[model samples]
Target: MATEKLGIRVERNPPESRLSELGVRQWPKWGCEKSKFPWTYSAKETCYLLQGKVKVYPDGAGGGEEDFVEIAAGDLVVFPKGMSCTWDVAEVVDKHYKFE
Candidate 1:
């Protein structure tokens, strides 16, 4: 699913071959404790979640529950350049990511 307004896209449980094609395992890995933080994407970022759950709220979302996008383990997610948002990590996150 793609959220055009926030320029974020999510692909759930992408095939292993697709992951291999993207060299996902070679991408730098990042992991964080369960927490909430604000983030701004200075460049386009594509990441594949190895484990975790998250809700990303675009800037100016006024803290509305419906304004966030949910992402989870086994999901491939992309955040566009210049997008500013808040990340609410409900579960510890472990992922492989690359900036484009």
Candidate 2:
């Protein structure tokens, strides 16, 4: 699924074969406990969540209830380069990520 305007893309429960094709397991891992933080994507990023729950609010969105996109375990997500946003992590997160 794609989040409008934010340009974030999410693929839920992608097949293992696809993960293997993407070499997701070889990507570096990153994780954090529940928290909220702002971020700016300097480069395009693709990640596969091993576990977690999060909502991403785009820059200038005013953090509105309707302006965020939810993501969680089993999701493969992409953040476009130069996207500024905030992450509201509701559960501990573990993911493999690669920047391009």
Which candidate tops lDDT? 2
Q: Please, what are the lDDT tens digits per residue for candidate 1 over residues 16-65? A: 99999999999999999999999999999999999999999989767775
Query: Across residues 8-73, which tens digit of lDDT does each residue of candidate 2 receive?
Result: 899988899999999999999999999999999999999999999999998876766789889999
After superposition of all CA atoms, the RMSD between model 1 and the true structure is: 1.7
Estimate the lDDT of model 1.
0.90
lDDT of each: 0.90, 0.91
Residue 94 alpha-carbon offset, candidate 2, angstroms: 0.3
Instruction: Estimate the lDDT of model 2.
Output: 0.91
Q: In TM-score terms, which candidate is top?
A: 2
